[model samples]
Target: MLPYLRRLIRDEDALLQYSAQIRGLTAGDIYIGSYFSVAANWLPQIIQAFQQAYPAVHVHIEECANKVMYDGLEEGRFDCCITTWRPFSGDWIPLCEDEMVMWLPENHPLARAEVYPLKQLCHESFIEPLPQQDTDVVRILKEEHISYETRYTAIDNYTTYRMVEAGLGVSMNNRLMTAQWQGRVAILPMDPPHTITIGIAIPSRDGASPAVKKFIHYVQQGISQILAPR
Candidate 1:
């Protein structure tokens, strides 16, 4: 009798799980997550395109450090999200590469230097951002054996940029964060350079709801078209 009960319980659990996956697909509401930097530059365009195609669907956007977004993905709270580049176990797309740039006060001694070598800036005060998020700053700094003082640590890119603009300290950032900055600052490339890989992560297209599947497909296609070479 106990053996028979075990089989019945297993079957019931499987049935419930399958139903949940089905609901995830056809659900008309979608929530997306992205990093703070890219949220401003990339998400608006993607949202506009997705909503235009799926007029009846409701979409929500949450911007945070990349790790926070990935945590949401693991807990199945978000349908899909943009994550730092990695060989994901689920459906993935290599969106684009972003080059890291050094930001310094306009009148700093190294401001006019043709290039800001990583080792050279190690002596200057560093305005670190998103210390918890996976970033190339700590990676390359450690690799090159460079060390510096953290004059300020920022949770968001805007605060980091503002500090650099005020001549409080220097920091590193990518194109997305630098764009639309109306302040005076010197931007330079690092020696040998570094890049951030951006990609889209979907839980699983086949296992997702119909609405999710449709929107994911549309996003992938539209991103590819826009990013294609001119």
Candidate 2:
């Protein structure tokens, strides 16, 4: 009976704490899960804005694979995620669209080609990135029935970029992934141009904590300003 009473008291205290945090966004924690590329390209500015608005609200970011990020969102382990939009049982707020492009050594014959032919992959040594995961590159190749030689398997896009820079092999990835990279790699659009939508995924905005809601709003605003016509 004493243990039950203590448990009830703890539950009530937790409820009270949650209520207070939501009533006035004075304090709360928001868990954000994202892909490495998304976190790198989109999170910094938005997070800065959010922090300025609510300094007391803590932001925790986790970088994970696409599947893991979406799984965490469904399991309530993540309040929100910045990732490529896919068919999931959640709400998605599109932030931007990214174009899929091929990476080649600057000295390669087709390096400056206007568009890389999908079938041409058959002649190149491909540097497959994240073979364990169905990344956009892998999915695009498979869906288009394009076959290539996987001479190297990179753990991430950065490694893939290095491999391509070293003339080890060619690769394909979203253009946004190369936003911060300065290496000499020729990025070309695919013969059949492919694009992916990247956005925020939330279980339910209506059920979000105050901090999470505010963070989402800031993300929307920040992205809007960045994407607006200059």
Candidate 3:
């Protein structure tokens, strides 16, 4: 009789209630994915502003390289990513465009030049960020038959900056990252200027979580405010 009673007393309502509570607890969590290099420049301000705006929301930030960030976004591991290099998929939002500039030690010959031509700069020792795939700079060098020697290769912008600063080699980087190191390194604008597109990538099938959406909005607004005519 006791065994039969246990089988008949199914607490389906209670089970559903427990599941609902679990889902509710997770609903407000936001997971953001981005490359360490770009994040190094923009994330601190973005996160601080976001936390101030929404103190209740839990923010999970995953910092990785560009390729890993893209892969994680595609695999549903992250809510979104802020990246300069866009994936082939069409689900990203265009945030901003930043010009790529050449970084050299202050004492380098061309460091004093207002703008350096790509062809001429290609003759010197170069330090390039090793992207997972061919980048625009690599394509340019190949197309133009430029034969610059690669002194060092780094996986992140910070390391590249340090290398260039140490006089190990010269490299090209986006303006946003270079902006923070103004006096530390000499940034020469590239002639026939090159620019890279930076943007946020989110899943197309489902809308981002409320917190994630708010953060994205914050980033877009913050960047616009900073870059707008002053």
Candidate 4:
């Protein structure tokens, strides 16, 4: 416990020094952790614009699973994180809403339906992505009491998409993640119409580095403007 306390003290000291540097608004590094799909779909433009505004303040992003990202933020390994809202002990503010949609083979019988039956998931072979993790997709299935048959477990979203395209199974994913991908899979909204709010999570705003607060505020405003009804 002595060593752990010493390490904590050192970390605190370093954070204070870093915070001072960022408060000057001249330069400092801010580390951000994010979930894979959120980073792929939402972070590029935000990071680019942030750098343009604060060129000397370097931003480092580390992408991992949702649970890991949340844990990292709590442990002080990340100044902030971008991910879906979950039962996390962190500060989360909504950025945008992403619809959860089903991906089925274009030639599949259910593909013709206007909206896929939510209960029909039990009858289809399901492609589970990131089986080891409790993502929004998996949580939705459990909450809805949908016991799906896992025909295949994919390591990532693209793999799951390909599996559905090949008729191996159907899978659900956030629509924004596949916006740029064109494939033989049919993306359809579910009967119940599920949606997840993607957001920024930070340990807390109090005592946070200036860079961290600036980035979060800028991202919030930017996304709000983009999503505002035109």
lDDT per prediction?
0.73, 0.82, 0.70, 0.80
Better of 3 and 4 by lDDT: 4
Q: Which stretches of candidate 3 lie over 4 Å from their true place?
A: 1-27, 35-38, 131-146, 182-184
Model 1 TM-score, all chains together: 0.80
Top candidate by lDDT: 2
Task: Supply the global lDDT for candidate 4.
Answer: 0.80
**Ranking of models by TM-score:** 2, 4, 1, 3
lDDT by residue for model 3 (55-161), tens: 76677888766667676665556667777555456377887888878888888888899997878865677988865545556765676577687867887678888
Decreasing lDDT order of the candidates:
2, 4, 1, 3
Query: How many residue pairs clash in each candidate at the backbone level?
Result: 5, 0, 0, 0
Per-residue error at 3 for model 2, in Å? 25
Local accuracy of candidate 2 as per-residue lDDT tens digits, 111-192: 9889999899999999998786657787788899998999999777798899999999899988888989899899999989
Worst 10 residues of 3 by lDDT: 5-14
Better structure of 1 and 3 per lDDT: 1
What C-alpha lDDT does candidate 2 achieve relative to the native structure? Answer: 0.82
TM-score of 4: 0.87
Model 4, 1-230: lDDT tens digits are 65456447535744764766657644566778876766776678877888898887778889766877776665667778888876777677888888999999999998988999889988999898888667888888888988789889987789889999999989998888797799999999998889998888877766566677788887887777667899
Candidate 3 clash pair list: none
